[model samples]
Target: MSYSVHVLHNGYSYLKDGVMRANCTCTLIKGPNLVIVDTMTAWDKDVLLEGLAKENTSCADVKYAVGTHGHSDHLGNLNLFTAATHIVGYSVSYKDEFFIHPFETGEPYKIDDSLQVIPTPGHTTEDVSVVVKTAHQGTVVVAGDLFEREEDISDPSLWRYIAGSENPDKQQKYRNEVILLADHIVPGHGPMFKVTEDMKDVARRDQLTQK
Candidate 1:
């Protein structure tokens, strides 16, 4: 399967749907710098490089390669961009032998002045989502494993894996943020969708009902 590169509203180019069920990487290009959101498997590294090179983006130009969490699939093949800076959440360091090298660092991506970290840790202790107001995308959430369009965020079954496992408190926090700040939901898996203004009220009502 051939992957198609699409430019997102945030002035980033993303790869969607090649193989392995749309595990994608989104790139933010500005001047000579690129910020790669996620890296796929080791086998797909060359393909990712080729695709980025075609768009005039490269690991050499990468300012940061962000792994949403410490999952092997998310950060394992990060060797492709040895030149790029690797960043992840504080909690990710707990994953055993997961750190191939000391190159990977940890930091939180700030949202607003008031809303800095959208700590959605149930997916993993390190699982955190980012909320940023982009010029074209308005308010959007790059919600790695925290939220997925493939399943309803409100689904109780979603809690089976993470509930009482680690940082279970974040499950409700994740749901609450989706209803408030998200104009668009950009998943690390599956398609991206906009949460309509009308839906905001419904989402809020859903939150209240769930409570």
Candidate 2:
């Protein structure tokens, strides 16, 4: 089955009390069931709800809420999805009424025939990326901090620098794997962009450097 993915916020950032608050990219996947990938910060709760309302969906309609990792900006509004199943890494802890399932590496959670949640683990040890097969876009990946932006592919070292990755080598390996597999990617804090041959070459070079 084909699915539609909507970007609620594409790398949105704002100033709050002189502090720059970055909002992670939040996506809503509409398929056999409603699934939300990475709910934005708590302050963006209204914005998230508004986006869902525009789609004729509310928090109640969401069946699953998946967090790429346990970051404030990524899982801040997680509690709002009280009716949906919350999926996160085993290390994450939350108090909610809904069921919370923790996923481990190498275990792919199939949301549907078109959507599969796979552990990408680059930006953080617990990171996961969602792979969606759309009718128009063959394989679209919802990458969390795995790729903050498209530039990360060209400058792969930036991910290690910015994320302060514990296992930089492993991160680069997983990132290269994702780059080779995904056709298009929705980054954690950037607009969706096509995965180009040039990007793949750059990623390959970065992978070689990690050896």
lDDT of 1 by residue, 162-194 (tens): 222254455555656665787676665546667
Candidate 1 regions exceeding 4 Å error are 1-33, 91-118, 154-169, 206-211
TM-score of each candidate? 0.65, 0.85
What does candidate 2's lDDT look like per residue over 31-122, in tens digits? 78788988988788888988888888889888878898888889889888877777774333334443334555477777778888888775
Query: In TM-score terms, which candidate is top?
Result: 2
lDDT of each: 0.52, 0.79
Error of 1 at 52 (Å): 1.5
Q: Can you give the lDDT of residue 165 in candidate 1?
A: 29
* For model 1, the run of ten residues with the poorest summed lDDT: 2-11
Model 2 steric clash pairs: none
Backbone atom clashes (below 3 Å) for every candidate: 0, 0
